[model samples]
Target: MGMEYQLFYWPSIQGRGEFVRLALEEAGVAYLDVARTKGGMENMLAALKADAHPSLAPPFLKAGDETIGQTANILLFLGARHGLAPRRAQGRLWAHQLQLTIADLVSEVHDTHHPVGIALYYEDQKKEAKRRAEEFIASRVPKFFGYFERMLTRPEHRGVYLLGARLSYVDLSMFQMIEGLRYAFPNAMARLEPGYPGLHKLHAHVAARANIARYLASPRRIPFNEEGIFRHYPELDEPAA
Candidate 1:
């Protein structure tokens, strides 16, 4: 149970796979980031076509024989096993809910750079991307951030973590959300961040966690770039008036 996971993800970008990586790192469990190794892309392709449970993409987690697909589903599994989530049904469900919402936010973030389709380059759809990104910065960003801020500032929560008393996978995902958004939309974040102090606080808290801080400092952490879901484009991230 100590070193029992093989995470198959693209060698390059942090992408969605990073959420699982952060969770595993924080749990202090050893996991092979399979695709990061030599000949690992082939291994990842093999994993995608496995007979019993084939996933059409990367970011699948291999937990023993079981291949957990999708970011939220993997976290749902990991949270239960690693005490990153609560034991009780209501609390566990709440953590899962937050993770799912974060997933949605990630999708919206991706669309900022690929509004028309994933197959096209950002330049190919640059016009659509600008429109999408502008709306995202003006509307969707606030919508998602506001919801999370309210969750953090809720009465029982007292603005510490998403699930109130303890740190959960949801909080880890929140850290990624802030990091990715800030990377992709720096000007927007600078303008909007002061309003969501709780989220920024949560991001800092997660960053300062012993394992996560180490991971961020290490070579294992993939640098953000145009290839990833969170791409930095000043054209796309038009500054607010």
Candidate 2:
């Protein structure tokens, strides 16, 4: 493609932007990870404030003169544009829905640490995080993963992915989620994995892809840390049920 796409996200952590980056990388598309570069986050913020329509958050994309925000929206836009989305209308809608669900899970992951408010530090809300993390580990994680597992096992789509016979943007997203959750809650994931063989296989499959393997090996894939979503607070994570 002649037009280079620009992705705006936090400079340091992978956060939500990694979803978009993975899709772009898998496609081998040439694009600018704006915030990762020098002066990139500043430029992104300036553009956001300068625009008539201020974005609700970071991880927006600037294609030509237009800018769009929301993690799932960015993926949908890129998925369609780059042919990473499913071709059939029904499949496309299902794929987008899957992506939205993944986004919801991601937000919940962030909320485990920032339940009271994003402004508050994890230490400030460590008690609250403990409570939220229990609910997340005991209820929410299984619910979300169960839904995905069932979807993957559907007769119409009986394969490793949400959509059978192809790896869509949602698959990349699921892989990211699996990676983050493993980092943040290693104990929980270890116990949980055996039950979700479909998800486990999907995670392994995505990691094995040539582009993803290359990306994971490269320094560009930021390490998970306490600063971002999916933090590893020992008190918040429980041994698998």
Best by the lDDT measure: 1
What is the clash count for each candidate, in the order shown?
A: 0, 0
TM-score of each: 0.96, 0.95
Question: Taking the tens digit of each residue's C-alpha lDDT, what string does model 1 give over 38-104?
Answer: 8989999987886378777878998888988888999999999999999999989988988999999
- Model 1's alpha-carbon lDDT is 0.90
Q: What is the C-alpha lDDT of each candidate?
A: 0.90, 0.87
Clashing pairs in 1: none
Location of the lowest summed lDDT over 10 successive residues in candidate 1: 156-165
Per-residue lDDT tens digits for candidate 2, residues 1-241, read: 3647888888778898899889989888888888778887789889788876568788888888878888898888888888788877887898999999999999999999999988877889889988999899889999999999998887777668778868899999999999999999998888888999999999999999999999999988888888777788877888656
Worst 10 residues of 2 by lDDT: 47-56
